[model samples]
Target: MFDYIIKNTSLPEVGVKNTIQLLNDACTIPFISRYRKEATGNLDEVQIGEIVKFKEQFETLEKRKATILKALEEQGVLTPELQQKVESAPDQTILEDLYLPYKKSRKTKADTAREQCLEPLAKIIMSQKTNDLESVAHRYIKGDLNSVDDALEGARHIIAEWINERTDVRNNIRYQLERFATITTKVVKKREAEDEAQKFRDYFDWSESLSHIPSHRLLAILRAENESFIRVKIEIDDDRALDKIFQRIIKSNNACSDQIEIAIKDAYKRLLLPSLSNEALQNAKEKADEAAITVFAKNLKQLLLGSPLGEKRVLAIDPGFRTGCKVVCLDAQGQLKHNETIYPHPPKNDSTGAIKKISTLAEAYKIEAIAIGNGTASRETEALIRRIRFKNDIQVFVVSEAGASIYSASKIARDEFPNYDVTVRGAVSIGRRLQDPLAELVKIDAKSIGIGQYQHDVDQTKLKTQLDTVVESCVNAVGVNLNTASKSLLSYVSGIGPKLAENIVNYRDEHGAFSSRTELKNVPRLGDKAFEQGSAFLRIKDAQNPLDDSAVHPESYHIVKSIAKNEGKRVSELIGNSSILKSIDLKVYCTDSTGLPTLQEIVKELEKPGLDIREQAKVFTFNQNIKTINDVQEGQLLPGIVNNITNFGAFVDIGIKESGLIHISNLSDGFVSDVNAHISLHEQVIVKVLEVDIPRKRIQLKLHK
Candidate 1:
């Protein structure tokens, strides 16, 4: 396993060994990356995650090898050479190929021929030493075989099966596919006229190198095929494939060689192409799934780690057209103080009454910010709110309404607000999202957050696993407040899962707020292991022990205290004293367990303990001239925020119904390999409209330098 990870990743063998051991010990990724830096050789979460991935892959491969070996032994074919081959198989594909001939299944042509005693005839023809093939085949003409031709055909079937079972033939075909396979599609004639089929029109006549197709395009084509709108075909040069097989199998120039050549062609078509082509396609699909999942995970991480507005009283509005904008006021802690409706749009366009209500509520609640949902009347709502002259300054923000409804209708939302409707809950979510994106966004599904590309078409299980990892990483990266964090947020902490998170919340409700990190031991089922893994990621504000509120683990509190004593100051006085921290030698503090890495991290933490790694959320304004796609034009410069990113491009929400796409080529003057490097989620930038198709509601943009 260590060698496999070392070969696959750039990590050293020792680092891989230690990381696997830590994972085997049930250490969470965030905990190991942050707290056990010394043991992991200062490996970050991603590098440790690579070790975990390769470790699981190696374990899976070993389990598969065991299963194959057991099956071979049961079949009475586990010879020394075969056992060695099976045991030495490095991956699942190779192991499966080794066991293919012995695998039991329903009857096939080859099986019937073998049952008819044609194996001897197959071997006779396969040798290609005899020119009188007809004479040799005549002896097998009995029972199921009525004539010489029938005997010869049955022998050919057996020969084809033998050739298909040869590992070299399959590997050669796989090599051909890996290098030369092309994916092509044609419209399903019957379904081509259907309304739903038009969505995949771009794919009807598409052809691309299977290995080079972008993950999004491949997934889209596969989706089209799944939807019955297109017939997808994976193709390679048949002549080239046959020639390669011929080179390996056709040894002589005779009637026997001719028979073997026929068998090789049959094997190539009937057995080899279908099975291996499908394998190649499956391999491609898995790759596409992995790439798409990576994109989704990155987007989810960025969205979760978006800048926070922090603890501020906020007035939130879930904008609407006719139902009236649902308004809610939240205190600094994101607790709802009041809820109501304001008719600021549509037939009930009582702008005067709406503005007056907003003004009065802002002053009454001491609102520090106004959050307007970027949905149906978002622009009008923002316009209406901006018209108001409040007594105190309030920064106004347009928050994405994606998944707000899902969160509002969730059980978590219902439990928090039993009397309020989904609208009120949704408004409160928007407000809280502005306050802390990581905290509030965790309540909703990551997919529904509208940051993924082809998320639905990818492998759902893989996508979920990766997104969960990202959420966990982000949640732990920004330490959760033990006293005030929601259950959803706490559930993602290092060792605390759903059950323990709920237990902690229940315990907190029963016994007020926690005074120290050690109090986590009192929560039910939060054992020593759980506390050790989780306590560092759970911060306590204004705790009795200052280290409890910082990222310094309780196990390391003595280290910090020792440093403070060496400095001739109290722990509190030493905290945030960067001058003293810089002057201290980290090497002097290194012990058998702790190393220079952990000591350096400790000193860095003492300098700015529990400080947010994210920037403060800032107010952004959209161009007031554009309220709809009709108002947009080519070559118009508009301020936009990057709302989504794909390998091909980044989509920017330009304050209109249609979000403009900045193609990867347009992202930079040189080459752009990664979209995230050029732009990130929710990054505000100026964009120039290069093209706009009003009929399709499509807009093309270029990054304004």
Candidate 2:
């Protein structure tokens, strides 16, 4: 199974085998990738992730085969040949087709005929050598078999069942479905007049080949069908399906052959077409689900790893329309210092009071930046902030408040701020996000982040797993600050879980701050294994040993000390000194346990200790003159920021409530297969408005040089 899986996966056999062993030994992906590079042959997080995926798939397939074998034995049909076939099945679909012939079901036409002693007649007719089929069927015209036609009908039912059970027939039908299947949808006539159904108007009469339909379209059509707003089906040409089945079953054209023909047609409409069609639909839906999840995972990874502004005192606002804006002042460490509300927009229209409050907060808390929520009245709030004159230079930014409300009402938020309201928690979140995106975003559910396409329709379990993988990768890539990091961020560290994370936080609160990474062992339940796996990715600034603050693992501390002594310098002298680092021989440090890959990363980490892999978050403002969609004119180039990314394109915010879509076709002059290849989340780019539909509230944009 491992060999089979590795053949399809990107990992080599040795790497996959060693990684599987490491995972079986209870190692996390990030831990193995960073710490066990030699054992895994330098496989990164992505390859490790694939190994985990294929491992689960093979386990599931094996488990399914076991159940089928047990059921066949219980049914007294466990022949050596059948058992061998089941045990050696390659995948779930093939295993199922092999099991279909003996599967138990409710009493069908075939079962009735078998109970009436017509099995011999079905057999004779199947041979297609009998000259008198009616005469043969006449003898069976007793109890439940009235006329020759009745007896022959029952025999046909049995023969149809036999044809349906044949592996070749089913496989041929499946092959046809794979090549020529089409998905068609039609609106439910009664539901078409309902207001709720209008959202799916574009899919009311849609038809497309299942082989090439886009994932977004398939998900949308399925959503409509799930809502009972439309009927969707997978189909292929009926003649093609019948012909394929005929080539496998019908062997003659005599009276018995005519009977076989009748059975084949019955087998198709009753047993084959419906089954294969459903299988095709399910297969397509699963493929669509996987594609959607991949897109979502990519978007999430980009969003979570977005640039951070580092430590700065910030004032954040959760903008509102009628209730004014909720504002909070956060210190450099994102600790809330004060909260207040200011009305700069209508109905109160107290611009003077709002401007005075803003200027006062900026000076009072020494706020260096301002973050306003990109929600209702966001543009108005931005305009108001631009007009305010501060004593010192302060940059203003608009942050997406997609999941602010959810996070505000969460238990984590409540625990963080027991005395403050949800609105205050929300405002502080925006400010903190500007300072450290991964730290702040980890506190909210990935589903509510607004970076998904049809997230709810995809498999929730798979989505959660994929999103968690992304978050873990991002958190480990940017080593966590042990002393000041939040519990949410620490939970995503290599070996630390939610319980251990909370324990670490409690210990920090009681002991003040973590002076060294070794102090993690003092925390309850943080054993040796956890420390070994997690310490390399957990940093403590200004620690006693400089290695604790670097990505250098504690297990390798002796190696570094030996080298430092040999060079007649302290270990601290070699840290981040590229001149000295380039002079050291990495090969001399390799051991039976450590190899070149591990030694190489050690050298790189020393060059830049505790480096943040992400770019620096910059202050971006949309076109100052263009404030709304109405102001957008076709062919006018404007500076914009890519806010959300999808497989089809990216949505760019051009100082408007509705972001403009930059379709993939316009991403480049040449063909573009992936949107992320050209654009990224939160990237700054110039775009020209291609089209605007005010009534529908849509904006189309194209990339500009």
TM-score of each model, in listed order: 0.99, 0.98
Indicate which candidate wins on TM-score. Answer: 1
Among residues 3 or more apart in sequence or in different chains, the pairs in candidate 2 whose N, CA or C atoms overlap within 3 Å are: none
Candidate RMSDs in Å, in order, are 1.0, 1.3
- Candidate 2, residues 1-705, lDDT tens digits: the string is 678668779578888999999999889999999888889889999889989998999999999999999999999999999999998888888999899987867778899999999899999998989898878888999987779999889899999999988888888888888988899999999999899998899999999999899888899999999999999988889887787777777788889988898899999999998988998888888898899899888888888888888889999999887989999999998999999999889999998999999999999999999999988889899989999999999989888887988999999999999999998999999989899999999999999998868999998998899999999999998889998898999999988989999999999999999988888999999999889888899999899999988888999888889878878889888887888888888889889998888888887888888888989888887788887778888989999888888778899888788889999999999999998899988889999889999988899999997
Cα deviation at 492, candidate 2, in Å, is: 1.0
- Report the error of model 2 at residue 172, Å: 1.2
Residue-level lDDT tens digits of model 1 in 463-552: 888889999999998999999999999999999999999999999999999998988999999999999899999998988898888888
Q: Taking the candidates one at a time, how many backbone clashes does each contain?
A: 0, 0
lDDT for model 1 comes to: 0.92
User: lDDT: which candidate is best?
Assistant: 1
- How many backbone clashes are present in model 1? 0
Estimate the overall C-alpha local distance difference test score of candidate 2.
0.89
Tell me the deviation in Å of residue 367 in model 1.
0.7
